[model samples]
Each structure stands twice: as C-alpha cells, then as structure tokens.
Target: MTNMTFSEQIWYGLFKPSKYKELVESRKSRSVLYILVILLVLGLVTFVVPTAAIITGFGGMNKLFSETMAPVAYDGNQLTIEEPFRMNVADTVFILDSTYYTVPDKELERDGTYIAVGSKNVRMTTIIGGEKWMDNITPIEQVLAPGFSNDSLVDMVPAIYVSLFLCYLIMCLLYFVKYGFLALILSFIINSMNKQMEIGLSFGQVYMVCFYGMSLGMLLTNFNIAMGLISPMLVSTVTVFVSMNFITMAMVSMRKGNQV
Candidate 1:
C-alpha cells in the first residue's frame, strides 16, 4: 500500500470519486488506523457544536448564580427565593406544603430532580443539576448554593471534557456498527448497478465506500444541526440519503470512466 497521508485520503474521500478505485485496490492491506482516525474525526465534529452550546449555557448560569443567588430568605420549614432561580448546579430553591404560593413542584418534577411526597405530591422539593433532588424538607431549610460554588463550577471543566470524550468514543463505535449495517443493505444495490455496467464492488468494498460516504454525511448533518436547519430526528434519514448519493456519484463516475 502507498503511504497516503490522511489529508490526501480526505481529499479523495470528499472530492475525487475516481480515487475510490485506489481505496478498493488497497482495501485488503488496511489496518485499524483509517477507521480509528475517521471515526474520531466524525464523532468530534458531530458533537463539538452541541457540547460547546451546553458549556456556554453552563458558564452563563454560573455567572448568573454567582451574581444573583444572594439574599436568600428562610422561614420555619419554608424558603422564599428571589427571582432568577438557578435550577441546575444548585439546590437553592425550595417548596413548602403549607404555603399558598407553592413552589414549582410540577415543572421541576418534569424537567429536574424532585422528590414526591404523599399521594398528593405536595411537598418541599429541591432542584439540583436540573433534577429534583430532595423532597419533604424540614423547617430549617438553608437555601445555600452548595454545588453551585465557584470551586465546584471550576471542577466541572475537566469533568465536562472527560465526559464528552467518553461520549464521543462510544458514539464512534455506534456509528461504525450503524454504518456497517446500512452499507450491507446498500451493497445489494451497488452489486446490481455494477453488474449492469460490467463493473462492480464486493460487499466489503461497498462497506468501505459507505464508511467514507458517511463521513461526509456526518459532517453535513452536524453542520445542519448546528445551524438549526434540521432536527436530530432527521439525522438518520439524511445521513443515509447523503451516503447513497455519494456512492451513486462515485459509481456514475466509474461507469463513465469505463466507457471512455
């Protein structure tokens, strides 16, 4: 096999349909290097935008909590928090069963962590990290921001990085399996088309083509997601269509070359 750099390989994968012939020729000589690199790149590119948005939101919330979460008031088994209540990363809000102005028990229950008390669900619930944390509180409630402290916020920096990295790695493996399955289905179409044109690919060759095809589709789908042009529900179908289109274009190019 030739010592093709990743950049050169990417150029071929993205732009030059004819170059897939070389990929097919060298397919048997392949190692895990290409798969690992491509999967890593795909996972990172797909996740980076959403992850950045999440981090930016967390930073904004941290700043808001630091600035506004002061002047907490406590009454006998009841706490009255000021507006701008920070939900995630803090458990500073509380609900009292006796108070007429009850806390957001239902909303917090739906979106966060909360403890339901009794059959009526009327109880003091604390929200932490966007989850309902504790239900049925005592009267001596301290609305202190325990986990939302500056130090704790700082700790999340490395935690977020590690989590995202692990998630990306897992996603890469899932994508590998998912695309492999889709390629197996697509290979039948490829075989029939190639037979008509007197030029065809093995199932393995089609699988590799689908893999490369999916790389471009992933980039495109992530771009669309980042730009809000499409919802995540459309991701699978869009990716399949894009991969099929890439393979079709490559096949057409190859057929034209054979005729010439």
Candidate 2:
C-alpha cells in the first residue's frame, strides 16, 4: 500500500474494496482527510462549467437589455416605458405591455410560459402538473425598488458570482456532513459485527475504511449531478447503497486477513 501511487490508490479504492484493509491498517490517519479533500475538490470541479454558463448567460441578458430595452420609469403607482417590449428566449416569453393588466390565457399554456409586465403589476404564469398556475401579482412599485434602474442589472453580475460561490460552498458542506454521517453509521455497524471475530478495529480505523470505500460512489454521484441524469433523491440513495456495499466488502476482507 505504501508503494501505491495516488492514481493507483484511487483505482483500487473504486474497483477493489479488499485493498481497503491495507489502506486502513498501513496508511496514516491523515489519509482519510486526503481522500475527503480530493472528493470535495472533485465536487467543486463539477460546478465549474455550469457556473461559467450561468455568469455568461447573465452577461448576455445584460447586453440584450442595454441594447434593446427602451428607457423605462416607474412612479409610486404605474410603470412607464417608452415603447412596448416583447422578447422570447427559448420557451419563455417576456412582455412589457402596459395595456395588458394580466398575462393572456394563451401565453400561460406554453411550456416556459409568460412573465408579463403590466402598468400596475407584473404577472407570471407557470405550468405545473398539466395545470396553469398564476403567480401572485406583484405591484410594479414593489418589484422596482426606489432608485433601482436597468443600469443596476450590470452591477449585479459580481453579486451573482458571489452568490454562486456561496452556493458551491454550501453544497460542499452538505457533502461533507453527509459523507461523515454515512461513515459513522458504517463504522458502528462494522464494530458491532466485529465483536464476533475479535478483529478489534477501532472506530477511527473503520471510519477510514468506509471513507476510502466511498470513492466510486462519490464519483458516480458527481457524474450524475453534472449530467442531470437523475433526481437528487435517487442519486443520494444510489450513493448510500454503493458506499455501504463497498464498505461491507472492505470489512469482510479485513476479517479474512486477505489484503492486510
């Protein structure tokens, strides 16, 4: 195990759970920390392309607004635009028509539906469960804060990036908590069963085994998320199942003295 390169360690961690016994016995305690850091870094890497696309999308929207949007003003009561504006991006339609007080029924039936800015309020319509759902009408004055203008949209780009970073941090924290909880549970189970064999593994050692065993599951979870292939709950369930299976195999190998 000491002779194994990092890539070989990862390969064994994913494909050969029996090798985890050697990892648990021969590796330093910090090996678990190293695995955790690697997993977290992989998680962060999965978000890079999506985050970049979001920022670029915002930039494009700002450019579109700057170039095409007419000068608009809002008083305490009504919103006034120099001309009625309408734009459709993909399936969603944005309309700034002061004459219409509500989103038209036809617009609400489409996939992405409509967000209509009327003189007094903004109305949004969404389709859920094959039914049209109208969002609460927001007053124009409430929607447009005082001193807020279209120019402020560009200023929000930095804040958007900051928000994305915070979200990524929060996600990493959740992953850490989730993985730790799984490791603790597996360690307890392994220790309880080990009483029969008298293998005498400590909680920390079992935890290290479990963490190392989780390599493949974590990678698959990240891949599924990046590809948007499954629901979050399904992905989580599969990860838990895979990690537990790998950890069980590792514990069995440890008991058999196969790879120690």
Candidate 3:
C-alpha cells in the first residue's frame, strides 16, 4: 500500500461499511439518533397541528372522519378525502402525480397547474376550470389534489413545508445508515404483505415487523411523545413467542420454497 495521509485513507474507507454491532451501539452515532428525534417531532407536530387547526377551523372535520369516514372501507385512491383533519396529507389537495414527497424535500406544485397569489400571508396558488385557487401548504400526503380546504398547506404556512423537507431527508438518510442491505430486503418483503408490520416478525421478516410496528405507532402517536416511541416496542414483547418456534418453521418454509 502506498503511503497516504490519514484524511486520504479515511475518505477512501468511508464508503465501506464498518462492523454492524459496533456502529449500532456507538454513542458517536448520535447524528442518526438526533435525526430520528427531529423527524418524529416534525411528523408528529405537522400531523397534530393541522389536525388541531382543521378541527378548530372546520370543527367537525376530525369528527366527520373518525366518526363517519373511517367506518367506510378505505379504497385509498378511489376515495377523495376532503376532510379538514387531513389538510396536511399530500395529494389530498392540490394535484401531484408523485406517490409521496421525499420527506424533507416535498415539492408542492409548480407553474400554472398549481399557483399561489395574494397576501393572506400565502405564497402558492393554482388555476383550474377558470377558477383560481391557492395552495402552498405542502401535504404530508398529496393525493386528492385540486381542492382547497381549511387545512390548506398554508396554515402554519412556511414552517411546515420548509422544515418538513429538511426533516424528511435526514430521516431517509438515517434510515439507510441504520438499515443495511439485509434490512432493506426484509423491508421490501414486509412492504409486500400489508400496510404495516408488528414487532414479533422474523429477523428474515423484519420488514413486516417494522412496518406494522410503525403503522400501529402512527395511530397512537397522539399520545405523549416519549410514550409514542416506546409504543412500537410493544411488538418486541412478542419476539419471544416468535423465536420459540420460528426456526423450525422457517426451515420448513424454505424447503417448501425450494420445492417450488
């Protein structure tokens, strides 16, 4: 090996992954921990604020959904969710073809399709069917675009859009740093099954485990922030049962897959 400066050597080796257990437990890895905290705060704040505002502004939007709409089967795209509770959910307003925003860099709309005008302290807008509507409130979800609501992406306004992008990028990057190739593969498998995963899923099936774990937690997120973090741990309690029998079950499952 040719002699190189410490910086040069460290730069080249940076691309290579270090041992997992080491990094996983390193106190120096607080960047990812901080990122998780920021994203959680951003997501929870974004969700609760607009939800609270919508409830305050339109009053019944939350009740309408939790009491009425939720009871209806959710067909997702087939349904146009115009409730006040989800004004921050993307595609629920405005119009974007993208599935979801990149977390920290959610692009609202551009050009004439969706535009913003005037000074209600607003900066985004759009024109459709000869009618002009403004929408700058970047959605937490962006599905039912083109309609305006009391939950317009403009509520708390700038703080939501700008901060969300930063928080989202950090969360995504941190997700990659924490979840390696095996976790990625497992995630894909879990994503294939259902909307969420529980904690007791197999190590090979950690995807589903984490998915539903997050999902269940998302629902109860209205609870205290600290509790919200711990709530997902409930899935871990189920791990003992899964471990007791899953090894033999996994071997049999693999044999069955091999036969196919």
Candidate 4:
C-alpha cells in the first residue's frame, strides 16, 4: 500500500517471525506511538520488584497470612488466642544431645571463635557444605557446605535470600541491557502462544520486563523447580511476552484503522 511490496514493507518487528505472521493475519490494533511510555512502564514492572524486594514482599505476605490465618485456641483464662505459636526464619539450629568437643578456658574470647581440638556431637548447620566441611560434619552425610555449612538453618534464609537477591539483581541488570525492549517484545509473543497470558501487553504496560525476564530464565534454571513454585518473575516474564505482543499489535492495528 505504501508503494512497497508486502514483504518489503514487513521486515522486522518486536514480535518474532512466527508471532509476526500470526499477528499480521489476525484482526488487531497497531500503534507505533508511545515508545517511551511503553519502555517506562514495562521497565518498572519487570525491574522494580527486585529479588530482595520479592523476598521482603514474601516475608511481609507470610507475616500477614500468619497473622490472619493463625490457629485459634483457648488461653489460660479460657480466652481465645488467634495464634498458638510464632514463626521465625532461622538459618541453622543445633540441639546436640551433648557437646562432642570440650570447651577450653572458661574465659571466652571476644570473638565467638572456638577451637575444635577433637571431634564432638556438635550439631551444626551451614549454608553450603564443601569438602573440608564434610570431614567434621556431625551428621557426616548432612555436611551442608564443606567450608560453608550453615550453623543455623533458621538464620540462613534471610542471608541466603540476600545473596540470591544480589545475584538476581545482577542478572536482571545484565539482561535488561543486553535484550532491552525488542527482546521483551519477542519474548512476549512467544509466551502468548504458550497461553501464559490471556492477552498481549506492551513494554510500557509492564515495566521491568527486561530485568525480570532474564532474571527468571536464569534463576529458575539454577533453582530447578524449587523457586519455580512461587516465582512471579517467570510468570511475569511469560505474561509480559504473550500479552505485550497482542497489546502492541492491537494498538498498531487500531492506529491504522484497518483489519489485518
């Protein structure tokens, strides 16, 4: 229509070739305006929720849920208590029947460091068990980290979450720069085909897609499926992909005032 062949007029789009074909064949709106708006919004959605933010949010959510749905029971005065117990996240907890290694010198050093003269029933928890750790592990088989076994599991979650948060953020930043909007658009279309989203969205509509999209791809793969259970990053990435394309294409078609 613009003095160019159909193929020539159609070169590259945010959508992949397959997605572009589907988008072209379908009745939709296509608008090229608001590139900045799309970028800003999608950037926020995908980037704003850092892994730390996510963990914090999850912690807050856990707090709220615990407070709201805690068990109710009778108190000493026959009164009702909504919660029977309080939950706290800890890294590691050790309840050894007895000390395997004897404590020397009643005067404890300013630092908490204690010398391990010999083996003892010292229940310990570590973050990551390594080769050296295995040698002195109480459970032997339960050697968490040779050099990094968590002394307490309860105390480690937040720290672990923090480390994960940092990695998660780094990956997000790296991918955001590497992929940017185009990658987001293409990813959006693919996820749409997978039915990850009911409708497509625009990069502007769901900010932070670039950061989160890559974050998820890397995080989930590392975690296998444990993180996947409650990972919104993956879900957002998928929704961002499928929904954005439909949304962008729809917007474009609307601008043209014509049917594909």
Query: RMSD for each model, in Å, please?
Result: 8.2, 6.8, 20.2, 16.8
Number of colliding residue pairs in each model? 8, 0, 27, 61
Sorted on lDDT, best first, the list reads 2, 1, 4, 3
Reference-based lDDT, residue 103, model 1: 40
What tens-digit string does per-residue lDDT give for candidate 4 at 1-260? Answer: 22323333222233222233333332222312222333333333433443335436546544433433333222222212232222222211212121223222332222222222112222322223221232232432233333321223344656755754554455445444554655556555544433443435444333322222333243333343323455666655665455444445544443444443
lDDT of 3 by residue, 1-260 (tens): 24444333222222212111122223433324433443464455544454455546554544433453322222322223333112333112323222222211133332233321111111345444444464454332243333433244334355545554664455445444543443355456544432332223334333323322232223234233323456545644444234323322333333343310
Residue range with the least summed lDDT across 10 consecutive positions in model 3: 15-24
User: Cα lDDT of all candidates, in order?
Assistant: 0.57, 0.69, 0.35, 0.36
Task: Please say which candidate is ahead in lDDT: 1 or 4.
Answer: 1
Highest lDDT against the true fold, candidate = 2
Distance from true position, residue 130, model 3, in Å? 56
For model 2, the stretches where C-alpha displacement exceeds 4 angstroms are: 1-5, 26-29, 38-42, 56-145, 230-241
Once fitted onto the true fold, the runs of candidate 4 whose alpha carbons sit more than 4 angstroms away are 1-158, 174-181, 184-248, 257-260
Better of 1 and 4 by TM-score: 1
* lDDT for each residue of candidate 2 in 59-85, tens digit (9 for 90 to 100): 665674565577666666677677888
Ranking of all candidate structures by their TM-score, best first: 2, 1, 3, 4
The C-alpha local distance difference test score for the whole of candidate 3 amounts to 0.35
TM-score of 1: 0.58
